[model samples]
Target: MDDLNAIATLLTKPEPPAEAVTRSRGRLQDRMRGRARRRIGWLLPALTLATAAAAAVAMLVTGVITPAGAPASGREVLLMAAVSAERTPQGSGTYWYVTREMRDMDIPRQESWTTRDGRRWSKGEPGDPPGVVVPDPDPLMLKGAEVSIEDLEKLPADPEALKARLAGLQGRDSAMTASEQRGDPLFSLITLISELPTPPEVRSAAFRALATMPGVESTGAVEGGHELRFPYPDTTWEVKLVVDPETARVTRTNSLSGNDGSVLLSAGFIRVTTGWTDQPPR
Candidate 1:
């Protein structure tokens, strides 16, 4: 009981230097802004709002006193993202081309193109030939099947219907164990849609659908944006979706493993620049 009391006392101890805390908060905010520009492609006019929200989060986490006004919650963030997506401008092109960066366990920076029709292409890194087209044998798989532009367009735009469809797919895969099947379908949907050239309305629907899922909780604001934590069924890792509420788009996503906080995968994708390009990728 004495040892337990000692641990509790340490946990409740006052934090160190206010100046240090303030500096840390500022750095975090700056990092978030930089990430927003790189990952989201564009910043919304309401970036000040995002800054304030991030400040509120820093104060809350560090036990610093903050001004009044309820900090945005996870559900509110998702819903706001939906609204933002709805207001986004649509694009037109002969072929949908998306540029993205993905970091998995092995690769730190893997830049690539995602095509609506599943054609593989990538921009060569510095010192490599520009516009190198590589044949990617991989298919754009969603919900255990290959997806095309037509498939994405056919997806339900209503939140409830979309949620139901995602939930229905949970147990349909016979190969997945029951535990593996319990993964958050809403997250999968978001990741898939972010990589595709979906219409603004469809993307909005995807955000709304996420808002309706159980266990979707906010971890408050971080550096780049607000984060939503989704627990996968029977897994130690949780999926975190960082969203820029001002732009109503996902800025970054990561799967964090175990108590040690190891990252399994991180992907940053944007479709804002995607359009039908008559010029084929070289």
Candidate 2:
């Protein structure tokens, strides 16, 4: 279909090569789309052609091949990210500033600044327009209630406690439809960690909470990120996120595929920049 949504510019990955590819190459492409995985190092020039051909034939005959060792699943990847996030130094300043854009939408990018204590918030317009200080409508959803930045600091660091606290937020989320209320609470956690400046330990707890969620699964890998799919109430389409495990940042909301082909859908704001800033919104 020629619909814009069918080819939305979400996640902003490099375009695939236009030329036709062979089946062996197609196999590799399929793996990139979520399947068996194997990390092959550089092929030595001295290796015999027969040996290479034999390996190719084996992969062809037996679907995808993985050498010895446990393949990394989505949960394992998230757990690894949790550890990475745990060790990262936390940032501190007067305000937590954020720049975000909805890639698939035509609206202008938005910027925001919130006092560390969450007492005040401001919305910045595109270009040089001055930021308008707004009311404290920026409470984070947790345990079916609104939570301020001060409360965020006091959240439990334990994965299980954090999970219970953030998961139920989705039920009370006004943005979610009645049907969406039945969706996974991981959605709430992911949204918070992706854009909000939660404490490093709290972010780690959220990652750990997601790791233990029942249906979180590795869909595949993306350049500079790992893609994981989560359960949503809607069955018509799938929800996947491209996450940078090193920084524990969710880079993109989703990259979905269908019978026709893959459709890149970006439903949420792409966090362009977020961290503590001493300077006021410029």
Each model's backbone clash number: 3, 0
RMSD from true fold, candidate 1: 13.4
lDDT per residue for candidate 1 within 1-282, as digits (tens), equals 442223223324555467765664565555545543222223222235346544443343323333333346676676656655665676665555644444333323333455555675555433335455665554555555455678767777776666666656533354343543664455446644455566776777787677666788876655456767777656666666777755665666653221111123444322123345656666
**TM-score result, candidate 2:** 0.61
Candidate 2 local lDDT, 114-208, one digit each (tens): 77656545455433345454554544444344557877777777777776665454344445444336544555676556656778888877887
My TM-score estimates for the predictions, one after another, are: 0.60, 0.61
Q: How close is candidate 1 to the true structure, as a TM-score?
A: 0.60
RMSD of each: 13.4, 14.5
The residue pairs that clash in candidate 2, if any, are: none
Residue-level error in angstroms, candidate 2, position 53: 28
True lDDT of residue 41, candidate 1: 26
Residue 179 lDDT (model 2): 37
Candidate 1 residue 80 C-alpha distance from true site, Å: 0.5
